[model samples]
Target: MSAARDWLFADIGGTHVRLCRWGRENGAGDIVRMRADASAGVADALLGFERAQTQPAAHAALAIALPVRRGPLRMTNRDWILDPESLRATLRLRTLCVVNDFVAAAAGVPVLGERDSLVLREGVPGPGSRLLIGPGTGLGVAALIGTTGGDERVLASEAGHMGLAWQGAEIDALHGLGRTRWGRLSWERLLSGEGLGWLHAWRSGAATPAPAPEVASRAAQGERAAREATQWFSRLLGAFAGDLCLAFGADAGVWLTGGVLDGLAETFDAAAFLEAFDDKGRYAATQREVPVRRVLAGDLAFRGLARIVDGACRAPMLRLSAATTHRHRN
Candidate 1:
């Protein structure tokens, strides 16, 4: 692919759908946010892109909130179906690639450099593997696995569906609050942006209606009930993130990205998070060595999309090198 050709980058999620053009570093640079809307479906969301911009002459790399294959991809959070060939034909693009949203996000982590990372702990991380999770419209999970030759492989996960096992007081709280009303307490039940608002409403017994952003904003401005709600949000996120860190064995560290962690300060309290995260008995110390941080910046998704393209492009070279090494050894 020619470096001059502009690649279209997108980040589709449960709450918001965003698309932009490639600027610098293929995508490690700035991106123009064309539109941000509810994740009703790909057809509806990409229409926003279609309305503003014409199709590019070169291939477009797409990063979606749902898992994607080369052909049609069905979104987990929505009913949208993404067909790259049709979209490419319609857009007049030469080629297309669809990647999972979280994987797209993980791809951006390496490109983040020092500026994008906010260190929660000091750990010597080297790229063995990395975990990325965030709570925006929903709780998204992904991991980065590195090959011996230094190639990073992205793995998308549906860990959000793993039922939330509330223990002790948390269990009592669920029962007291009337489990039926909560609609099954999954990890997402109290880990996402919307989940924060739900937690606040339930804990405060407030009848006020507002979105998660509003709830977090209000809490940020000094709402007592909002504050308490955020604390619970933090604790739950820590528990879940720690579980993922264990599952992936991400010695490289864990990144807590998304608008949710950005809004709630309570989630940044390393003491509490590490306390809960490291509560894993024998493996606690090892887990502690894995740093935690929040990704800060608007263009990260764009950069991440670029990373996937670059990595995909370079994959053959890595394989070639491995094959050459085997021949030499033999």
Candidate 2:
């Protein structure tokens, strides 16, 4: 009999779940994107995908947006929770590996295509660490540690929860608003979709908030408030990314991902973003030397999962490693 060659990979985010099948030829099939809302059962989605396979998959890897230190993980930006043990039983897999979604994105860096990203800065990548940060439902961060052997190991982080830091009175006022409402503010609070809504409301004085996509659409139609909110959003995001780059010593490069940035790619003020990214007082020189790019590949976490299941990357410690380093402290 032919060897059982099916492997499964999933990138579970707050808004959507992307699932793909890796075949014996080492190629992935079309990504199956599903909305991740109250009605979507994780098990049901997996089973539905599994029914198309000739034989059950031998292994599965899931890159989830939430921190993965142990079992029963609740998403930071959504109302869904997952139990690894239950998923293993329900999916009937020989091995199941769950990793932070950013970890997987870091792993896929080695394979990111030339057309897969836009270079925001042109600094050559040093033989050091690379940073990956994405602002989706919440912010995601991770680093790819480069070794002398040319291999890379992904280190997951909860850097999104790090305090929101910026320079300028306008940003300070926004910070004040965040602090007043939440008592504590992280980078995620102001750099995500919900963050964009809050910014729009703060700028436009709208009694009712609007979704982020609508704000972007309005901005395109020459709405001043939406335009300014989007501009500040990009600018603040740049400054936050610069802080992360320095903190991690990611001299190689920094990659931006997530649906928020992705949607604003064409309209986002790239020059303004670069200005904030390079405005780190004394460290400005080094910051300017570090490259920045936006990942354009869809389902990047899913691709990273494929790399892990195919033995192209380090094998994760599954649930144990997640629990040990799962704390989201700076």
Candidate 3:
């Protein structure tokens, strides 16, 4: 019996797209092809894959940060809107699983292991489930739900847009940010990339530039005002972490991910961050019980999508046809 079949996967972020193929090499573990671009909807990035002489795979999976209801999926933080059925037809994959990005990320947690994680607390996470929240081009949230069917599901969240948590000085800052464009503060008001820039501007009492890249660059170069902006950014992240821990009863801790966290790693001290997180009035001890970890594994969501497609990347196929060629090596 032959044990080889090809599978496809991709991770589409707000700023870029990555696509890859995976299959067994020598009848053992699965391996992946070099990642290719399925760029942000400008042109079809799968043209080469379509033209390949080899017959295509029977299954594929796409992990996107957009809602996948049935028809149209407009991304929360970007201009790309994808038609899942249309994409599946174009790819000609018999089984193309569409999943939420945060769900995908949460699914891969089991395989991600320790090396891919960074510890920010030391206590037990308790009976509460794990929560994942990330602030970047947009904010992402998910809950790792244990199912009654003896399986697990990652529930996607719109909590980022829920509402801004205002307290003490944060209220004034959010009010100022809200007035810049709107009349009231929303969670995205102080939790997204653009929001970070606004916070930096308000804290520095200076006018923010057109693009956000400038704000980061100025901070990295040691401008006192810019540094304070970055510091405030870290402070808010800590506060939000505390809120998530409380909301989910996630004594199991919470995770932080995405590109923005990647760059701000150095600016924020995890210990100091935890201190602010625990400063949550009456919930102080509960806050201390939860920990925070940064999800640095970039391919987390990609690998998770692969699992949803099959138990493992190259697990026994669920859909097979006569044309399902099993290429054998001598």
Write down the RMSD of all candidates, one decimal each: 6.1, 3.5, 6.5
> On a 0 to 1 TM-score scale, where does candidate 2 land against the true structure?
0.91
lDDT of 2 at 172: 66
Residue ranges of candidate 2 with Cα displaced over 4 Å:
1-5, 147-149, 315-330
Please write out the lDDT profile of model 1 over residues 130-237, one tens digit for every residue: 888888777888877775336556777878878785544764665444467665667876677667877887778876435787777777787787777777777777
- Candidate 3, backbone clash total: 2
lDDT of 2 at 137: 83
1 versus 3: better lDDT goes to: 1
Give the least accurate 10-residue stretch of model 1, judged by summed lDDT. 321-330
**How many clashing residue pairs appear in each of the predictions shown?**
0, 2, 2
User: How well does candidate 3 score on lDDT at residue 28?
Assistant: 16
lDDT of 2 by residue, 1-330 (tens): 124447678888888888887755757777888787633666767888788877787667788877775658787877778777788777777667788888888888778889999998889677668899888888899988865235657788899998887756776666777778888878898889888888888789886568989988888888999888888888988898888788888899999999888776576888888889889999998888888899998967866776665666662436322223233211
**Candidate 1: residue pairs that collide:** none
lDDT of 2 at 264: 68
Please provide, for model 3 over 85-131, each residue's C-alpha lDDT reduced to its tens digit, 9 standing for 90 to 100: 56666767665666777777777765767889888665775656778
